[model samples]
Target: MNLHADAVTVLSAWAPSLGSQESLRQAFLGFLATRDDTVQRSCEAGHLTASAVVLDSTGTQVLLTLHPRVGRWLQLGGHCEPSDASVADAALREATEESGMTGLEIGAAPVHLDVHPITCSLGVPTRHFDVRYAVRAPAGALPVRSDESDDLRWFPVDALPAGSEDLAELVNAAVSSH
Candidate 1:
């Protein structure tokens, strides 16, 4: 199936843990129903993005990136590309590239959904409908910082950096279900 079909299938099957998330899912589905180009970054209204809350093999650590543009430590993710087969593929690809880890495993369904406004490379303000997944890295995984991020590091699940409350919520939801 195509990326749009894959996104619909995945989002349709996923059961959000919170009522708020379910509402977002319904909103996303609604957006997709009218905007077939929702997966593209050029979509002026807003676009869907994929992200991953990466956990260590023991599930005690979470890897995060200091987003260059956002200037805050956040989970690994980005806009969908033509090369990405599906939204899940985009999430895994972003996670692996940003973390530089080889044996990462992603969950079958997304763990969280968020909608935030930003002025990205498109140079215009738009909302990012972020679909986040829980990904697990190898026990001995070592990360190499990619140019895409200012920094990439793993922090204890309980003690993320200051002002990372948003990521904390995503991590908590992912850890509980991971």
Candidate 2:
């Protein structure tokens, strides 16, 4: 199937009752219909990005990266690479790379979907349709900061560092699901 069709299939199969998730599902459907570069980084309008909410073995803590560009404590995720076979695979790969955890387990369905604006490395303003999945790290897993982040740390699920309210919501959804 084509990328847009594949995205429709993925989102249609995901049963999310939350208002945000529902809105995102609808918006993604529209985006797919109107935009051809759903998986390309150079899409000035916007493109799909995958992210992972990495939780500890007990699910009480979550790993967050201090994104240098955004300067926020956010989930471990990034642009969708050409090698990614699915959105979930992109999220899993990003989580493993950022968290330095070898045995990370990621859920098949996305736990959250968000569309937000940002500036890409190419210095172009763009939007990202983020598909976020829940990922569980092995016990006592420690994250290592990559070039994409300024710092990497684990925070209690209830006591996330000061950041976006959306981050907290993502953690809640991930925690309950995984």
Candidate 3:
């Protein structure tokens, strides 16, 4: 199937799993229904993005990047590329690239969905319809900083650095479910 069809199928399956959050789930499904080009960067107003909360092997600490553009310590993720086959694949790919680690385990279902405004790499103002998944880093894994981030580090899930309350919520939601 083509990329757009694939995204539609993926989002359709995921939407219902978002129990009790009818509005968020419907919003995603509605986007898929109305926006045939939702997966593409050219969507302009907004586009689908994927992200992950990377947890250490023991699941006590989480890896985060200090995003240069956003200037916040957040989970590892970014815009979906053409090579990404599905939203989950995009999340996994972004986690691997940003964390500099191999063999990280990721699930197919998303842990959270967010719509946030940001400046794209091309300097365009747009919102990201972000689908976040839970990923577990290999034991003793060390993450090297990527060009997208100012720094990368693992912090205690509960004691995350200041200004990371949003990330803390995602991490908690992901961890509590597992």
The local lDDT score (0 to 100) that residue 161 gets in candidate 3 is 94
Off by over 4 Å in 2: 1-4
If the candidates were sorted by their TM-score against the true structure, best first, what order would they fall in?
Answer: 1, 2, 3
Ranking of predictions according to lDDT: 1, 2, 3
Q: Write the per-residue lDDT of candidate 3 for residues 18-38, one digit (tens) a residue.
A: 464446667777886787788
Residue pairs in candidate 1 whose N, alpha carbon or C atoms collide under 3 angstroms = none
Better model by TM-score: candidate 1 vs candidate 3: 1
True-vs-predicted CA distance for residue 125, candidate 2, Å:
1.3
Question: In model 3, what is the error at residue 108, expressed in angstroms?
Answer: 2.0
Model 1, range 117-136, lDDT digits (tens) per residue?
99988999999989999999
lDDT of 2: 0.86
The number of the candidate with the highest TM-score is 1
By summed lDDT, the worst window of 10 consecutive residues in model 1 runs over: 165-174
Pairs that collide, model 3:
none
Report RMSD (Å) for each prediction in the order shown: 0.8, 1.5, 1.9
Q: Residue 125 lDDT in model 2?
A: 83
Query: What is the Å distance of residue 130 in model 3 from its true position?
Result: 0.1
